[model samples]
Target: MISDEELMALMRYVDGECTDEEATAIRAQLAHDPAYRRAYNEVRQADEALAALPLLEPSTGFNFRVLNQLKAEPHKAVSPISLRKRLLHISGIAIFLLVLPSVLLLLSSGQNPVLILDGSWLPAVGDRQAQVALGPYLQPLLFVNGLLTLLLFDRGVLQPWFRQRHQPPA
Candidate 1:
């Protein structure tokens, strides 16, 4: 299919509305591109046909027939959301809002949340050398842990809950 831009250019070329440079470019395209040429011909034919068509007047009963058809269809009542579902949605939003602020406040307070790790299974970082060596990797380790937690949370809880909530009743 020819793109809208190409179609517009062809239409303008057909209508003698394009500049000389644009018309030349379009003419080159029409000569070299079979698809573009076909599209241009189709547009030109449609425009000519529309111009040749006489102005049409609707029949005297057209409005009456349309109104009668509209009246024949039964009206549908929109069902309000159930109270339980509404409450569930509201609670989810409320929890998110509350926890977001608490998390932001804690992070902004500049107090480092301490982690107590059991490193007894691993080789001891004797003296201060190994600890210093591992210090650079601590941030990356924390970042990976946070990313994994979020992925697991999304897969296990968020996705299931969302699917259940949005799925239509069978």
Candidate 2:
């Protein structure tokens, strides 16, 4: 049986890939060894068959269509860092808006409005003192603003991005 190295050398000889010295050695082997001759003929036949295969031409405007498709896509998915940055931006805006009123109030009145349960400033429900304070509103405002920001990001950014990524090409 012929060794793997002999077979490889035969293939390289058939493909015209061997150096002058290697080609001389393989030619000597092919003349003397029937196995080398057979392997060389097989490799030569396969190479001819592969070369004879018709080259397929793509449809017209293939490059244009591919480029247009790539340009149309905005993003495959939102990265975690970008999402974090977006959330931070929304929160910063909300926090600024929330704090602005209080800052303005403090500046206008020059009085720190503490969490007071005085019913006099609030709408009277009964004899009980209603809770009238910025401290109470702060938590609820933060919660609502954060929730709205997240919802908006999901709807406007994430949902569309995921849909585009998953949708089959036309």
**Candidate 2 per-residue lDDT over residues 104-160, each given as its tens digit:** 575467454565465555565544664455655555765676676667667656876
Q: Number of clashing residue pairs in every model?
A: 0, 0
For lDDT, the strongest prediction is 2
Model 2 scores a TM of 0.37
Write one digit per residue (lDDT tens) for candidate 1, span 1-170: 88999889888888889999999999888889999988988999999999999999888699778877774545545346544544555565555555556555545666564444545555674333222233345456545655655655565567767987997653
TM-score: which candidate is best?
A: 2
Candidate 1's error at 32, in angstroms?
A: 0.5
lDDT of each: 0.69, 0.72
Lowest lDDT block of 10, candidate 2: 124-133
Q: What is the lDDT of candidate 2?
A: 0.72
Clashing pairs in 1: none
